[model samples]
Target: MAVPDPRGGPAPAARAGRPRIAIVGPTHPYKGGIAQHTTELAHRLARRGHDVWIESWSAQYPARLYPGQQRVDAPEMEPFPATGYPLSWWRPDGWVRLGRRLRRRADAVVVVVVTPIQAPAYLGILAGLGRAGRRAAGPAVLALCHNVLPHERRRLDEPLIRAVLRRAGAVLVHTDAEATRAAALTAAPVRVAAMAPHLWTAPSRRVHAADAPAAPDRAGEPAGQATGEATSALGGPRRRLLFFGLVRPYKGLDVLLRALAAGPPDVALTVAGEFWGGQEATQALVAELGLADRVELRPGYVDAADVPALFAAADALVLPYRAGTASQNVDLAHLHGLPVVATSVGTLPAAVSDGVDGLLVPPGDPAALAAALRRLYEPGVLTALAAKVRPPDTAGGWERYLDTLLEAIEGQRRVDHR
Candidate 1:
């Protein structure tokens, strides 16, 4: 028998025993940190004895809107068994249909919200779920907000975010700062869940001094002057620093280049990952700063198989982001047992315990950033920081994260029942 509600549609049937959970986000075929995080969470949840299903996008973005080369990466070598549904982003009808199916099948649905661009699709899906809930109790909705507000903002961002958040039963954020921001936007209960390292395996190869590349020659400069402070620290080879991830305006790559130009001439840098805003300006900046020889730029998405070698070659990872709520790159650095030199913004202060696992400097200050880079070569500084670095599992493991998520779900359920 079905229960009746104010809207007058047949109510969804209530279930007993273990909960059926569905994750609505990008996974596997999709590339980037968010996709990897979503896929990893689904596997961890399934391992913890829950019936899990993942609802992934058939078409995430139109090519015109996406600046990257490809939408999906090559499938991961070790794949997780997920019942992935290829739902189109532009189809409201498909959103509603999937929502209705999820309402009937699952006890809870976790939605991963990263950008405001997808709010329209989510709006339609939630609307369908709301209608189903009014007739009969529908699955509880949990919004796992990777970013409550995007790094870049536009006029419609606020209204769109608020509308989508209102439809969620609970909101999960990575930091306390984000929790406060989410609370200000909606009345939805917000939970703070720490982000664990995304890398599941350690690097197989060890980078040796012979593997280091020689620093490029600076134009119109004598060989002795080109060697700079870095040569004095190490007589053998230049130490490598990695500036990784998607190149965006907010990421402060220009700041890093300026710092590199001013810092010791003995250090070399590798800029990996695809460029979002085009690489012309960055390349121009590198040449203008006379860092052409010192900086090696690899423009494109890095495959999963090659990540370990990249990390193994660097002495430290540098993130000079101008603004951010949280960073998964910090976690990745720690997971790889490498020290990080990141700006003190968003959750970075909490992520890198200044002088412990990494060093923190004020954002957008080239001199400060350069000083921090120099400090990495100081006696025992890098060794001390690397010694404190802990694997993500040991730091706050996946089990703990899953437990926090379940608690949020149960808490929301109790409030709804009341």
Candidate 2:
């Protein structure tokens, strides 16, 4: 049945119960941290008894713009159960149609704003929702900003972000840092919500061919001991440290390679996820740094079914991002009981508790990062850190996250009424 458009006239009588919500972003058939996050949020909201649905994109990005293979390889681990509509990002006309469809059934709309490129389509959708019309009592629009501005900023990014923020009744950012950035962009009431871990289910552990010898004891050696001092312990199958997710320059893969070259020789770093650019530079750096035997580059989109094994096989996850607002990789690693070695950039410090769940190093500092990696091989440090790690769901969890989202939506509704 076609639901009535709530904004066609004066504000209708309030519903007695939960508000219906429509989450706008990418979902199944699309693969990435954002898509996975949207899917997880939708399911979580539905479980909490709110009527919810996800309006996913039919075309997220153009072929030329997206470097990796856009499809998921495994299907056995699909988590979301809510129905999703595939809306096109390139079609402004389609935005109006989808907006109208959502306005009829939903009391609120949560639009996932990741980049400036999505501003045009979202602007059209918001315009159709009465942002420019007399029907100002339309469904509350909340811009769930993943990144207020892209790491590599473009000329029109500010104006485009301003255009969208102006239309949103409220802006929701994942971290305090991101909240600050979003507040600088517009006067919209910005709210900060913690990014819960992305794992909806426990991932399976990947089994290797044979058990490798334990790492050598680095009991009293100074932090900057030469590679030879750590060679024997690292010689047998090296301890695997993972650098997961899309291989982008801003993510600092080069920095990680340099760190690996300088760190203990027995540790092998796995470079998982699809490479966003040419791998020649990274490969060349590895060879130049004499780390050819210490790094494994797995360049392709990792499927959900394969994620468990990947995290299970690794001793720790390393994120050497030069710049980032937040990390789903940290959440994923913590979910599987693996410690993270992340740089103190953006939201990473907030996501990872130094010496508690993982260790934080200065961004772009290969020496600091290498020292952290070496510390991971120290007796009992990895196990001790992993023991203290808390998954997002356990520490305040998704219920709290959903409450914050709903509260923001309710706040927007109250503002519209006023």
Provide the clash count, candidate 1. Answer: 3
Per-residue accuracy of model 1 over 272-303 as CA lDDT, tens digit each? 98999759999999889987777889899877
> On a 0 to 100 scale, what is the lDDT of residue 59 in model 1?
86
Best by lDDT: 1
Candidate 2 displacement at residue 10 in angstroms = 18
TM-score of each: 0.85, 0.85
**Model 1, stretches more than 4 Å misplaced?**
1-17, 131-137, 200-236
Candidate 2 has what TM-score? 0.85
Q: What is the Cα-based lDDT of residue 293 in candidate 2? A: 71
RMSD, every candidate, angstroms: 8.0, 6.5
Model 2's C-alpha root-mean-square deviation from the true structure amounts to 6.5
Clash numbers, per candidate: 3, 2
Clashing residue pairs in candidate 2 are 206-309, 234-266
lDDT of 2 by residue, 101-219 (tens): 66666789999996788888888778767764434648999999888888888899999998888778899988888888888877779998887655533224322101111223333
